[model samples]
Target: MDWLLKATTPAEKILVMFVAILLFAGVMAFILYVSEKLPRWIPAVGFLLPAVIMLAFGLLWPGLRTIFDSFRDAAGRKSVGVDNYVTVLTNPDFQIILLNTLAWVVAVPLLSTVFGLLYAVLVDRTRFEKLAKTLIFLPMAISMVGASIIWKFVYQYKPATANQTGFANQILVWLGLPPQQFLLNPPWNTGFLIVIMIWIQTGFAMTILSASIKAIPDEITEAAQIDGAGSLSTFFNITVPSIRPALIVVITTIAMATLKIFDIVRTATGGQFQTSVIANEFYSQKFSQGNNGIAATLAVILFVLVIPIVIYNVRQMRISEGER
Candidate 1:
């Protein structure tokens, strides 16, 4: 049992993993054999028992433990009650993290969905539609860390006298302006990081919304044209309404992703200079600062904040299904 928790070497870890897998396979084999011998109703229960047990141990136990830890002190020995939660909610530094998170949640989804919708509408039936959509969606194909690194170079700052390597600062230099420190500043650095997320998510929104746009019946657009509607009129009145469900789904989905955004912030700014969001802050608290209680509290807050968005997303999906 002690060895199970002490498998630090690569070979030891691999051996432990193999043993776990072997044990899992044996248990599954035994369960299947016993299930075949059991009654029909009992067999269904037998088949589900393993999955239920796994869920309990894997998800339920960890969640409960985190919640329990949130009430403890940083040392994990003394009871702190609600102090961790109170500090997270009321402290000025933590408030900045919360505000930065709020900004991310608001900006990323709205801007991504808007840009995606506009691009989808513009390229809906154009000659280079596939190429255009592909260009926008290529960022989504890249990992967040990769995209962040790419943008990092784009925002890289150098002395005004020195030759600029960053694309963004080069543009400023070309225009006779000084190169700005994009990642060293507060508030604006957060905004710059948010842009990376928007850049990545726009492709997903465009893909989903584009498919939804094409599903619009040509008859409706033709009818609007017959009624003397302009392009903007038809787009706003006909095209948008047609993709309302998809719009909701895209916005809510992006909102959820934005809430849990860690990679972009971590890679681009390392969550410094007041650019930290909930997920990044959680990691900093747990690992760098070694404040387990605050980390757990942040996790719980993140979980609670995400619940409404998830519920709304699920409800919208169900309604869309019902309408279909």
Candidate 2:
């Protein structure tokens, strides 16, 4: 057991992994062999059993526990009914979080999609088009945490007297203006953080939308042009309507990602300066503050928020498929 806990050598760890894999293979083989000898339904049961058990243990049971914990006290020793939910809904800090999250969900997807669509259109088929699209889409390759760090330096503020290390403040100094604290200011700080999300997610929006735009038949554009439709008119009248489904999917996906934006907020702001959103607040309550009840309540709120978007996305997908 001690050796199992700590394999000191690389060879020992490799040997342990090999043995585990061999055991797993043997168990799987034995199950299949036994199931073949049993009734036809037995193999079907065997095939489904692992997945069912995994769903139960991993998703269903934890979800139920979280929901159950939402109604319980912080220590889980007593029931508190709706107190947790009420507190989260009415508390000023949590209210601010909800508002910030709402702003993020509204602003990021819309702005990102708009920028992405514009960029996609700009470089549609011009010379160096691939290079241009690649540059715009490169941000999506960076992790959220990495993007935040990159933008954090970009937004870094310094005292006017000090030599400015931050790009933003350096530009201010060069322009004979005062350096401003970007992340330290509340409300506006949240907006600055939201910009980071938009920058990263814009590439995702562009990639999807560019594909959708390319799929739009060139004949339609040519006919529109023949009808004296300007480029702007063609985009609004034909290209947009043709790609509406992809636009909806992009917006919904980004909204979901924006709602669950934790890494950037946590890594950049540490949920301070009134920049905390629901996901970050959930982490704060659960791990930092040890307010388990409030954490569970926040989790439930996030879950509720996501359900409608997911349902709408699925419905839209089905509608598109039906239309096709």
- Identify the leading candidate in terms of TM-score: 2
| RMSD each, Å | 2.8, 2.2
**Residue pair clashes in candidate 2:** none
How would you encode candidate 1's per-residue C-alpha lDDT over 1-324 as one tens digit per residue? 665779988988998999999999999899899999987598998889888999999999999999999999986888898999999999999999999999999999999999999999989899999999999999988999999999999999999989999999999999989899999998799888888999999999999999999999899999999999999999999999999999999999999999999999898888888899899999999999999999999999999999999999999999999999
Candidate 1 — which residues are off by over 4 angstroms? 1-30
Instruction: Summarize candidate 2's per-residue lDDT along 1-324 as a digit string, tens digits.
Output: 665668889988988888889988997898788888887676888877878999999999999999999999888779999999999889887799999999999999999999999988887889998888888889888888899999999988777888899898898889999998999998899999999998988889999999999999889999999999998999999999999999999999999999999999999999999999999999999898898988998999999999999999999999999999
Residue 231 Cα positional deviation in candidate 1, in Å, after optimal superposition: 0.6
* Strongest candidate by lDDT: 1
**Ten contiguous residues minimizing lDDT sum, candidate 2:** 1-10
Model 2 lDDT, full chain set: 0.92
For model 1, the run of ten residues with the poorest summed lDDT: 1-10
Q: What is the lDDT of candidate 1?
A: 0.94
Give lDDT: candidate 2, residue 280.
Answer: 92
lDDT of each: 0.94, 0.92
Q: Which stretches of candidate 2 lie over 4 Å from their true place?
A: 6-41
